[model samples]
Target chain A: MNKKIKTYYLLTAFTIFMFGFSYMLVPIYEVFCEITGLNGKTGSINSTLVIEKPVERFVRVQFTSNVINSAPFKFSPGKKEMVIQPGKIYTTFYTLTNQSNQPLLATANPSITPGKYAEYFKKIECFCFTHQQINANETKELAVQFIVDKKLPSEATSLVLAYTMFDITKQLGYKLEK
Target chain B: MNTDADHLHEDHKTGIMRWITTTNHKDIGTLYLFLSLTMFFVGGAMALIIRAELFQPGLQLVNPDFFNQMTTMHALIMIFGALMPALVGLANWQIPLMIGAPDMALPRLNNWSFWILPFALGMLGSTLFFEGGAPAAGWTLYPPLVLQGGDALPYAIFSIHLLGLSSILGAINIIATILNMRAPGMTLMKMPMFVWTWLITAFLLIAVMPVLAGAVTMLLTDRFFGTSFFTASGGGDPVMFQHIFWFFGHPEVYILILPAFGVISTIIPTFSRKKLFGYDSMVYATASIALLSFIVWAHHMFTVGMPLAGEIFFMMTTMLIAVPTGVKVFNWIATMWKGSMTFETPMLFSLAFIVLFTIGGFSGLMMAITPVDFQYHDTYFIVAHFHYVLVPGSVFAVIAAVYFWLPKWTGKMYDETLGKTHFWLTTIFVNITFFPQHFVGLAGMPRRIPDYAVQFTDFNAISTIGSFGFGIAQILFLYILYKTLKQDVTADNKVWEGAEGLEWTLPSPPPYHSFEEPPKVE
Candidate 1:
């Protein structure tokens, strides 16, 4: 081939090779993404929290808690201090005793902030955030199981969990801190 | 025909201004190719920016709105700018040769079609730098949201109008040329596959361009006037807009792929050293695909809460299409079977096309299942599926056609080693970019999101890097094109030993006006 013809062939060959090479690269990169999760981090709940508690309760019981920086608390019991590690679920129990001479009623209410994120993290089975009636001198224990997000930043070290016990008769609420 | 006599007397000059002013089919084809090349680079650059943004997640390179614009424009550019124009380029260059016509039936109309594209794309691209940026509501342009765009909306809408007009005119010109300008002995059956494919494709264009024109015009009126074509509050159903749009849109897909089919049909037989298998069946299959396209519009709208009966009707019809498509595929394989196959660049690309496009077709079948589509809809999986079809399917066919015909067009042979190198690199990188998208979609990642939850970060990063590699690979294509035009390589009248068609009967770099005396056909 003449110099001009040689150049033409070289150029045409180069163009075809480039398109073919690019075509092959698509699947390889796909496999890399699946293996590395470099595109996005993937995590599933290592453990789920299960809680068992009695419905009726009486007495002024306060719940409060703090979470360590590495672990972000997803839930808390009414006015009790609890500690848990990241990637691990922990459960705590609290008992309330009715001391009034007559029948006494009490209830626990739960709520969270950053509402959208809370919707995904917080779990409740029933309408248990309302008041419950109890006979005088009755006793009950409330329990909750919860997991902290391991993906939480280390800078967010301490998380506050607070709960209040309310007397339905007097419309009085008591706060608990831990 | 008398058109040949007229073509002979037309002024054919040899300078740059001649190319700019010329109405000859050959000159217009050259113009279309050059224009599409420029747009290809422009669109490729936008895609690179999108990949860069997804490289590490978060708002790193651009804000969400701008990111959306990049994605939307990237799609529009590749589909409209790159694929459509390239096919038109091929049509301009090959249709007359295939039909044994001296020139296009309406040469001025051909020039009009070729000239309008630049202005249309210019208007569309200018919106990116304008106040409030380009149309960021994705290329689908679903109403209520698209109406919310600022100054860019009118520009984008008008640009679409121009593009539609250009396509309509081009279609009209093709129809006239094919119907009126065939060689004396050429009957419909005797016409080459490329010409037949374009004849059907052009009819489809005439039928649907008006629908698109009408739909977009209504959109313009809905935005600016008190018209309520798409506004839900105005008693017009928003869902109806999708119906009208996809009515034009589904056939639009066939419009893009059929010419590609024609190109591949021509290339595969030539390289395999065999006459095309089932020539009549191929013709019938093209017609079937085009006709089925009209009814399958509702498949795209299955998720929009259509009635069960409508869904089933559209679903079955869409699935039925696979039959004709399968016929085409089987015919291609049968053509290559037991033939003396050569591993030329064109043949290599054609072989890759058969395998890869079938994968695209299979995924499309999966989408045809309404229940399955619900899960895959609006996800990265859809992205992966279409790219497989468009990139390796239509786009690769165009490249193959270019390689197959470049020697004849330029009268020079291109470098084989570099061609193979480019091919291997592109084929590898393309899959890396789109394949992982399937996994990400299955993993619940949505499409069109600028940032994703941390879980999706890993795959997104890999896809992004792969995209960069794929984008840069096209530079090699440009280099090769430049080299071919600049060189003076000698080529025989029949560029490939197995090549058949009236085009090969002419000299290398065929005359501006060919077939002054139409040759006898057997």
Candidate 2:
């Protein structure tokens, strides 16, 4: 009987430990995702590189934007399309307008597809790299600077880069609206 | 030690209180079985609604939201409420008797475990009337979508939490009873296959149930507390939820089926009148299957956008499960190879379980190939695959266990003719209901929708009719049970001619206590 009682406690403790471990999986996964960029995330580049005597390989880049969760914001690229050389840097701007009555905190996640081409699409600087905060009825200009790698497979002619904006005010513990 | 007096004393309570307060293993087993039966009908009705709505598509019977709610709730009720509890009921009733123990190691906890279920389920079932109706987000409760659910979400999560607690406690009791309460000479390897399978299952429940709790808890907090564990906007990845949930969810499939494996392993040999073929291998196979379950979870997520290497790895590991599973199937057939087999209702159901579950397994193998799953994922093919496994696989085994043991428990022999009628009706309609799903699914009809294209109409109509037939057959099952009890025809001590076990040594409907004194095994 005493032995049974002891086993009971041991099993209970194991259950509790697994419960806490479940929460721990979140952080562990986040670390793993960051390292692997497993969830369509691209790494940030701190130093800008200048391509001299560039390959000048022209590739058509298409720009698009979306709001996740039906967030009350109108977001779009400054230009719908551009043709640029792969080895040289280019900058494009996007317009974000807060249509709601309250200030909002948002995050923009970017994806480039033909997803395999994402490896060659380098972003030296992009507004999607950080959170964006806009006040009520505020409109903001966002910039993206990138150089598509010349080493990108020759068969690839064009790539679509899209940005998805997410409502982060509730998730990040900020109550900016009534 | 005054062990008999301590274990076998009569309960002083009467009526509802006897059920509410009784700690006896058999009484609790009865409670769990009744609860599972009730939930099975409740969930089954929801399934009928789904089938009816899909009968000819075009939203004939219910609105899409209500339809989604039925689909979602049916899975929740069946998995957590019906199938799991039924297995536990069997464990509670049979474990002590088979092991030669006086009772479960923790009897009081056993009582608490059975009682918590109704309250948890009541909270769940009442959600139909909630503002904006019940959760339509499907059973996976994948977020961003589930976060859009109405007032019922919290109640559902809380119910799952309660269910998890009940399972853990029951598992602890089973483990303790098996480890410490076995008869003088019964060793671990020498224990019945049913006991061995359940012992492995208990470890699985202990290990994975909390992981499910954690996943649902994160969902709760994400909805209420603004935690971004799965919110993509807050740098939390929604796919992470899939990884976490399936980490628990894959093992959960085994948690439901392994005990069914235990039941099937027990039944086949008795009917064949032979010692279980490859008993040592069956034990090893079950353990191997349990271990394999953990690594193959990502097979469920092959389309959730994992890398090529990850996909290949998950695919390989998933296919490897076929080895042990095939071992189990081969052993059952080998046991029945040339023995004096009697096709009693239990044996019939067990035989059907093997054939149908293997069919389900083959489909499972088809989907395990990463490329093939990309085509099959979320299609009616996937639906067909799981339902084949779950309904005929788990549910059939549960039915088999009931037909096998109902006489033992009630001390009354149910009419064998009515029993066979239920079995044939079930086996025929179950295949009718789910088999065409593979046809429609492979031909490209998606699942969880209220409407389908005109091309898929015939198969869906046939499938729905089959479901109704299956549902009606169960009413006959109930009627047979009622007649068995009401007619008062007593069963013999050794109910079957070929039966052999510590359980058979005791009288039919054994005593208030499982054993008045522990009996020696060998």
Candidate 3:
């Protein structure tokens, strides 16, 4: 009977340990995803690359903007498309107007098309990394500084950089007038 | 320990409190069985609703959103609510008796484990009435779409947590009982196939149930706590959820079916009137299948656009599972080769299980080839493949086990003519319902949709009618079970003539305190 009770406790402890281990899988999976870019999760770099000479090959980079249906905002890219040399820095702008009666908190999620090139598309600066607040009828121009790595896969001649904006005012406990 | 004193002291308790507070294994086994039966009907009703709605192609019965909810909830209820609990009920009733143990190693925990199920299932079932009408994200509960689910998501998550806890506790009890409570001289290899299969299953449960718990917990926090573990806006990847989920999900499919393998293995030998041929190999085959289950999870995700190398690797590993699975099927056939055989209800189910489960296996092989899966993925073909394995493979085995053990448990013989009639009705109807799904799927009928293109209407109508027939046959099953219980005719101690086990040595409806002296095995 004592042995049985002891084994029972051992199993209980193992179960608890496993419960904690499950939380750990999140970070472990994140690390794996980052390392492999397994799900097109783009990586951030701390230092800027010095490409002494930009690549001569031109890739067509297109900008696309969308707002979730519930989000009361008008958003669009300043330019629809551009042809640029790889390894050279490029700047693009997006315009956002708060269409609601009150202030709103929002965030943008960025995705790259031909997902294989997401790892090579380095963002030196982007508004997607932080939350932005806009008051009633307020408008803002957001800047994105980026460069396509010369190592971007040759198959991806045309890349679409898309950002989807979402309204988070409700989750943060702000009221939206009906 | 005096056996007669223990029996008198234990059996005197009456009323609901006896069930609520009792620590006896048999009472808990009865509790588990009854709970599973109630859930079986609940889940079955959900299936009928799905079949009814899918009967026509023009969205006549339900909106697409509600249709998605029914499909999602139906799977959750059937897999977690009905099939798993039934197997646990069988384990609770038969494991101690077969191994000559007085009771499970942790009897109090056994009581707790069985009791947790109703609350979990209750919480899960309550989701249908929630403001969003239940979780519309499929049972896999992939994120982003699942993240968009309304009020039911948290309840679903909590219910899954409770269910995971119940399974983990049940598994611990099964492992402890099998390892420490076996009669003297019954080596691991010498244990009954049911016990062997369950032991492996418990380990699989222990290893994977926590993983499922973790996945759901992440979803809970992501949905409620503003965490972005799966939210792309917060730099988290949604596909990560699939990897974590199928890691648990693939083993879970095996978890559902391996015990069925044990049941089929037991029934085949008894009806063949021979020792199970290749017992050692069967044991090894079961273990290998469990191990193989872990790596092949990605076969379900072949359409996720994984690299060719990854796809090829997963495809190869998934196909390799056929080897051990084939070994199990061949051994069952070889056991029946040149042996005197009887076609009783149990044997009939087992024979059907071999042929039909192999067909499901071959379909699985078809999908494992990465290129072909592009056509079959998320189609009714995939649905047909798994249902063939689960409905006939797992569900049929559960029914076969009930018929096989009803005599022993009830101390009265079930009506054999009715039993055979129910078996035939079920076998034919089950095939009719699922077999046409393959054709419709091949004809490009996508799953989880309420409406379909007109071209696929004929097969869907046939499948729905077959489902209704299948559903009606089960009502007959319930009536037969009730009728058997009401009869006063007692069963023979050895109910099946060739059935040999420590369980058979005891009386029909074995005593309250079985194997009080711990009988020795040769």
Candidate 4:
């Protein structure tokens, strides 16, 4: 009887452990991504690598900026387009204005197309790497320092660097309405 | 132990109160089975509605959104409500009897587990009445889209949580009972196959039910608590929900079917008048299938854009499942290879299970190739593959089990003629309904859409007619049940000559309280 009761307790404990493990899968997935270069894929790069190397190969890099619908913010690229040599650093500024009364936190998610060029298009320093908090009625200039590595394929002629601004205030526990 | 308090409690066994408060294994088993039957029709009605809408190129019976609800509800009520509870009902009745134990290890918890289901299903059904109607995100309830649903979302999530909790508790009780309450000298290897299959299934429930609960809880938090577990802007990827969900989802597939394997294993040997071929192997194969279920989850997400290596790995593991599953199928065939055979309703169902489930298996294999699945994904082919396995595989086996054991449970034989008639109609219509879905799927009609291109009209009409045929045929089953309850022929203790096991030795319509002192098995 005693042994039977103990087995019940042990099985109950195992059930609880599995419940917690389901939540743990989030971090576990992130770690798996890390091991597999999920964080490295088109995310960030060493600026010194870009500053030290220079190549004569030039690629047309176009910038497109947009914000989520009803996000109450005006956003655009300071320069709509540019052509830069591979392995050469270039800076582009994005202007963001908070059009609402409440201070808002937004994250600019970056995408590059044709998507295969993502690995070569590195963002050495970009406002997109972190969340940007804009005070009410505030305007901000966010700069992106990026380089196309020399390994970019020769046939690739054009790349679009697109940014979509997502309002993250409620998600971050800021307790504020967007 | 027969004190006055016990006697008073025993009196509760007769009236409506008996069902509400009793904890007896057989009574609870009956309750589970009845719930299964009721929910099967309920879910089946939702299926008919889905078919009615999809009967032609344009919407007919319901609007698009409501049509989506029908598909979602049909899957939920069928998988969680109908098939799962039926298996649990079988376990509640058969496990203790097979092992010579008096009852389950935890009776009160067993009662609680059974009771929670009705309320949970009720809450989920009420979601249809919510201001915007029930969740129509399909059963996967993928986020971003699912979050857009109105008042029904929270209710649906809560109902899922309750269902998960109920299954988990039921699993714990089954595990404890199997581990601790076996009759002396029965030995683990000597136990019946149905019991063995359920023992593994219970563990699966324990392992994955919590995971499902956690997944739904995360959905709730993402919806209400402002957590970003599935929100991209909150540094969370919505695809991660799929990963977590299928982690539970794939095993959930096995959880539905493994017991059907047990039921078939139990039925085939009796009707064949032979010992099961490779009994030990059947045990090992079931375990192998369970172990493999965990790693092969990503097969469902092949079209979801996984990394190339991940796709290759998932495809390989998914293909590997065919090996053990093939082992189980071949063993059943070998058991029936050259023995005196009977085509009783149960035996017929089991045979059909082998043939049709293999077809489902073959289609699953077709979808296992990453590139192939990209084409088959979310199409009628996906619907056809799972329905073949689920309807013919799991649902058929449950029907077989009930027929195989009905005489034993009622102390009266059901009308074999009517039984076989029910079997034939069901078999014929089930094929008519699901077979066209394969061609429709390969023809590239996506699922969950209320209407389709006119080019796809013929097959969809045929499928709908088949579904209604299948639907009406079920009424005969209800008639057969009603006749059985009004039984005139009393069944003998050993109902079938080839029957083996402690359950057969016991008198038909086993004592309300049985094996109280435990039978010694050697």
The number of the candidate with the highest DockQ is 2
Q: In candidate 2, how many Å is residue B472 off? A: 1.2
lDDT (tens digit, per residue) of candidate 4 on B191-286: 999999999999999999899889889989988887788876666777889999999999999999999999999999999999999999999999
Docking class of 4: medium
Candidate 1 deviant stretches above 4 angstroms: A1-178, B1-10
Q: Write the per-residue lDDT of candidate 2 for residues B96-177, one digit (tens) a residue.
A: 9899998899999999888889998888888999997888899999988998889999999999999999999999999989
For model 3, residues B271-361, the per-residue Cα lDDT tens digits are: 9999998999999999999999988888889888777778999999999999999999999999999889998998899899998998999
lDDT of 2: 0.89
Better of 1 and 3 by TM-score: 3
Chain A, candidate 3, TM-score of 0.88
Classified by CAPRI criteria, candidate 2 counts as medium
Q: What's the lDDT for residue A132 in model 2?
A: 76
Highest TM-score against the true fold, candidate: 3
User: Cα deviation of B472 in candidate 1 (Å)?
Assistant: 1.9
B345 Cα displacement, candidate 2 (Å):
1.1
Q: Summarize candidate 1's per-residue lDDT along A66-87 as a digit string, tens digits.
A: 3222121122444454444544
Question: Runs in model 3 with CA error above 4 Å?
Answer: A46-48, A51-60, A81-88, A148-159, A173-178, B3-12
When summed lDDT is taken over every stretch of 10 residues in candidate 4 chain B, the lowest stretch is: B1-10
